[model samples]
Target: MSAIQALSRQLYQSKLPWTFEFNFNEPDYIEQYWTHLGGDLTFNRPINMMSLPSHFIHEPLPGASATLATISHQQALQYMSAQHLQQSFLLSVHQYLMQNIQNNIQLEHTAEHFQMSSATLKRKLKKHQTHFQAQLDQSRLHTAIHLYRVHGFKTEQISQYLQINDTTNFRRAFKRWSGLTVQAAQS
Candidate 1:
């Protein structure tokens, strides 16, 4: 479904861990099968939801309407595969940026690292509706958030990690990115 594909794309872009919730009274044979297949199954929850670590592919159960379920499963598979491919492309860009966060990464440098011309890389990113600087800022914002919230890093430490010479600028940027002050985000 388009809805599933959109959610998958969003999850892939965010690169956040999540848990799946299912609404079932008990663990049925079908649930056990999915669990054996490495699916995280949480039953008797208030809602039915799927979590995507990176463009998750939902597998249909065996015990469903043969005709309708088959059609739906095929459609879902197609969407999932397509979304996975798109996410892979974006991941390549983001990974390169994050890995070289300490260095002053430029488009040409990144393109050379990836073995492509800068123009070509730009075109590819354009196709994805993102540019290098945007990705860089997003990666930094996520890292800063994690360091501050998870690792309990102070604002000055986070600013140094992000290569922002001024803690004030980092604070302003964090507020703009998350709509929360540094103290608020930490809390």
Candidate 2:
């Protein structure tokens, strides 16, 4: 969220003195945060919302940004575009893997789902400094962590939910993923 605010500031530097409006999915904002936002603090967020996405928006006054912001604008655009491409692929892969966590994961099937050959998927992931296994491990580890710590699920339950088929195997896999025993991890 701070990244979004800073990016908005740079992108709208030409329109300095712009009014900032924030809509947070969280119920409240810290008053300290308003000091850095550099605009009027007006609250127009939804009420009684359980889940929503937060937004950092800049509302320039009338006739603001009449001139170009130039270097900052160009740099911001370049950064955003590069980040979008690189992160989009990884995010897509993670989302797909997460949704099918209970199933046996396979690189070939994942490649097919992405409409590409297995080798092509491997190449793309390598370019991003990762491979299929790392992504899969990350997804599994996160799910395991959440289930174990947050939901207080037993090892057997987690193993069954993740379809690992055996409690001992799940324990070993969990140790490998997190470098800690399940009980130790909870502590």
Candidate 3:
């Protein structure tokens, strides 16, 4: 909410200054949660609505810099898709795991999602030189990072969301996954 204007100043060109709106209608006590965002961000609107999806409307990137970045990203995607079927499979698995992160994810259940027997899934993963446990860990790590960094989720919230049940174990897992503490990861 606070940093978008500064960040946009560096990378994008637009006709008018950008405005932001958060749709989550919150109360006064919740104001403390946003104070760290900086005092300049006190502007709020539609003070009555319960909730709605937020969107950032921006013009298309105008320069060759955008063109080059887009082309490079597309090339990387094509290369990864053609050369790493295993990664594509693991990516699907990662998405499934993230979607179900708050629940206990089991090998058999993940196999069911892919329309295969558990053994078949294990064998396929083994061929890829990886296994289900590693993917689960990766997904948990990713979800934790996204929650904490992008959504401002606290350790307790992220712990429950990842189904860790215990905060200390979740802390250790986050440290192991990213080599940084949760707060440090934000920077």
Candidate 4:
């Protein structure tokens, strides 16, 4: 089962209303849930409806028992397909970076990681209409946004994680990727 489906199943098994903040329709809903959970967790980032399904299993009812349940096979297949695509994109980007971002690193390392020649990798990326730099920039932007918003990390830390020299470029690039500044992106 996909993360979201597993979460939904856990929610149903707990016999609790699927609830928590980040309900896209209600800005204040998540804060209240965090309060009820006796902690200060917050979905400080801008909430989107598509992200809701991922959290359903996280808020379990107290005094509830877990149960094994089944979902429709067709729905399961569809969920798995979407999940596989997401995982593939994430893993490829991650592995590509891991093998290519060391000192004097090169694209040839990324191609080697994929067990293909650099030329083949280039051709495949062209067919997809994307380049490695674009994907790397996107991955960095996504990670920076998440860390800054969710963990309240500073710009310097974010830049460091992205393996960039300075925070200024990180800030400028972040603002370009996300309309909000890093400071503003939090909450």
Clashes of each: 0, 0, 0, 1
Per-residue error for 171 in candidate 2, Å, reads: 1.1
TM-score for each of the candidates: 0.52, 0.55, 0.54, 0.53
Candidate 1 lDDT by residue in tens digits, 9-115: 46455423445555455554765535432355565543355554534345433344689878998998899898874547789888878888777778899989989
> All candidates' lDDT scores?
0.69, 0.70, 0.67, 0.58
**Candidate 3, 1-187: lDDT as tens digits:** 3355445545566322433333244456656644533332322331111111234333454464866888999999998789874547877887898888888899999999999999999998999898999788777876876676458898999988887869998888877765567666544
Candidate no. 4 TM-score? 0.53
Of the candidates numbered 3 and 4, which has the greater TM-score value?
A: 3
What's the lDDT for residue 173 in model 4?
80
lDDT of 2 by residue, 26-55 (tens): 225556556565434444321111111223
What is the per-residue lDDT of model 4 for residues 14-74, given as tens digits with 9 covering 90 to 100? 4233323231243455565444432323343333212344455475655454442234556
Off by over 4 Å in 2: 1-87
Q: Could you tell me the TM-score of candidate 3?
A: 0.54
Cα lDDT for residue 48, model 4?
Answer: 28
| Best-fitting candidate, scored by TM-score | 2
Worst 10 contiguous positions by lDDT, candidate 3? 43-52
Question: In the order shown, what is each candidate's alpha-carbon RMSD?
Answer: 13.6, 12.6, 12.9, 8.6
The model with the greatest lDDT is 2
Candidate 4 Cα misplacement greater than 4 A, ranges = 1-10, 13-58, 61-91, 94-105
